[model samples]
Structure formats: C-alpha cells, structure tokens
Target: MEINVIEKIENPLLNRTEIHFDCTYQGEATPKVLDVKNRLVATLNVDKNLLVVHNLKPSYGEGKANGYAKLYDSEENLNKIEMDHVVMKNKEATKEEKEEAE
Candidate 1:
C-alpha cells in the first residue's frame, strides 16, 4: 500500500495537527485501521500514543481509501479531545494490554 498525505492543518486551539491522507493499494484489499495507523505513525515520526485515526473510508469499487488522523501535543490533550471509540480503534492491544485495560 502507498500512502500520500493530502493535507495537514495545525489546530492550536485543540493542541493537535490534523492530517488528511489517501492510501492506494493496487491489487490488495483495503488495509486495516490499525495497519494504517502504524504506517502513519512511522511516516509522520509521531508518537503512536498521541496519534489517533479518526476514520478511513475505502472508495467504492477501488483500491483506494481516504482517511483522517490527529496528532496531539500530549496524551492528555488527546484523551480530552478525542472520542473513546476512535482512540481505541487505533490501538494495537496485545493480551496483556487487553487485560490491563480491563
């Protein structure tokens, strides 16, 4: 899969940077949400804990998807501004992590 960042906007009021991106996978299925989040963390050089994937929508009848993500200045701000389900969607929880969360 190839990811292209379409736009980035700094939201000072929210203490975060919002990103819009497109992912292209010529012959592959639409990537998983966690997979896309990991790629964004690596490509943007941001802490995974402070980044959240809000949504990723695959284009109809195409191997392309558009997504939105946010990079927060701190974990505090991230937790405060983002919805619980969205943050959880971006997390890659192992057995231990799942136990800890419970």
Candidate 2:
C-alpha cells in the first residue's frame, strides 16, 4: 500500500496535527488505522500513544482510500478530543497506559 497525503493542519489549541492522505490499500481485513498510525509515528518521530486514526475510507469499488489522522502532544490530550470508540479500538495504547500506570 502507498500513501499520498493531500492535506495537513496543525491546531495549536487542540495540541494536535490533522492529516489527510490518499492511499492504495489492498488488504481488505487490515485496519488502515493501524497502518496510518505507524506511518504518522515514523514521520513525526512521536510516540504511538499520542496518535489517533480518525477515519480512512474509499468509495465503493475504489481501491484508493482517503484517511484522516491526528497526532496529539500527549495521551491525555488524545483522550480529551478523540471519541470513546476510537480510543477503545486502539487496544495497544490502552494497554500501554495500563503498563505505565502500574
């Protein structure tokens, strides 16, 4: 899969960066969110816990998908703005938070 980003925004008040990318995604069962999260982490050299994959989708029959994501300054800020379901879907971060608190 290849990602071509078309938009990027940094919101200081939110303490996050918003990004939109167009991607050629082939794996049907793969969660694009995970891929996007990884890409953003590598690109920004930031912790995965601070990233949120908002949505990634394509129109029916199209292999190319549009994706949106945000990179937060910290896990707390991430939880503050992201939806509950989104936070739950990313089990990795939740587990990390638990380990950190222990």
Candidate 3:
C-alpha cells in the first residue's frame, strides 16, 4: 500500500494540519482500518509540524471497515482526515511470489 497526500486542512481548535492521502492497496484483501495495526508508514512531513497516527492506540475503536486516519501536532492534539474508498486490485501478485512461481 502506498499513501500520497492529496489535500490538507488546518484545524482552528487543535491548531494542527491534517493531510488526506490517496491510499492505494495492492494486496489480496481490501485494506481496512484494522489492517493498519502498526503498519502505518508516514512518508512525508513526518518530522515537521504534522504528526500522523494510526489505530488510535489505547482505545482501538470498534473495528470498523471504513475507518479513516488521524493527525496531531507537538501538543498531542488530534485532527481527522476523511478517507474515501478508491480502486483496489484483488489479484495482484508480489515480486517474490512471481519469481518463485517462474
């Protein structure tokens, strides 16, 4: 899965910026919020003002199928990023797997 920032929004109350990503899944099963457990890799602006988070540790909410990601700042405030379900490839194969098959 590769995530690319599509947009960003600044929150007045939290004083943090939330980045929306164009999430794409090339795995077998559709990428769900549950699958993001400890697998989230913040590629862009991680060290800057924006702090990306996943699975809201300590209180893993009801394992919803369509749960989005969140962001925070140095103060530990939270901001929500609305994620939309995009195109997914069901029969994609990995490089190692393809090599072994051949």
Candidate 4:
C-alpha cells in the first residue's frame, strides 16, 4: 500500500492537525485502519499515540482509498476532543492480530 498526503489543516483551538490522504493498493485488499494509522505515523514522523484515524473508505472497485486522520499535540487533547469509542478503536489491536500472536 502507498500513502499520499493530500492536505493538512492545523486547528490551534483543538491542538491537532487534520490530515486528508489517499491510499493506493493495486492488488491488495482494503487496508486496515490500524495498518493505515501505522503508516501515517511513520509518514508524519509523529508518535503513534498522537494519531487517530477517523475514516478510511475504498472507492467502488477502485484500488484507491481516501481517508481523514488527526494528529493531536498531546494525548490529553486527543482523549478530550475525540469520542471514547474512536480512541479505543485506535488503541485496540485487531482480533486477527491477537489470534496470530497466540
């Protein structure tokens, strides 16, 4: 999978940077949120704990996907600004990953 950052908007009030990006995976299935999040972290050179992937949706029958993510300046702002489930979603590992680790 390849990631290309499309846009970045800084929100000082929220203490976060909102990112819009595109993902291209010609032969692979839609990438998982965690997988994309990991890539974003590396690409942005930020701590994984500070990033939250809000959405990732594949285009109909297309090898491309578009998504939105946010990078908070701190974890405190992240927990305060984001929904509880969303924060948990990013923190928890996938079930398949857990099974594989066993």
Query: Highest lDDT: which candidate?
Result: 4
Residue-level lDDT for 95 in candidate 1: 98
Give lDDT tens digits, candidate 1, residues 1-102.
888999999999999999999999878888999899889989998888998989999998889999999999999999888998997888788999889999
**Which stretches of candidate 1 lie above 4 Å from their native place?**
97-102
Q: Per-residue lDDT tens digits of candidate 4, residues 1-102?
A: 999999999999999999999999998999989999999988989999999999998998889999999999999999999999888878866799899999
Per-residue CA lDDT of candidate 3, range 1-102, in tens?
555555667776766565555545553344544334223333553542234333222213322132234455653443233222211211135799889999
Q: What is the C-alpha lDDT of each candidate?
A: 0.91, 0.76, 0.42, 0.93
Q: lDDT tens digits, residues 22-72, model 2?
A: 777675644457776787678667788877778888756666778887878
TM-score of each: 0.90, 0.74, 0.41, 0.90
Estimate the overall C-alpha local distance difference test score of candidate 1. Answer: 0.91
Candidate 3 wrong stretches, greater than 4 Å? 32-41, 45-68, 79-102
Best by TM-score: 1
Q: Residue 8's C-alpha lDDT in candidate 4?
A: 100
Off by over 4 Å in 4: 94-102
Greater-lDDT candidate between 3 and 4: 4
Candidate 2 lDDT score relative to the true structure? 0.76
Per-residue error for 25 in candidate 3, Å, reads 1.2
- What residue pairs clash in candidate 3, if any at all? none
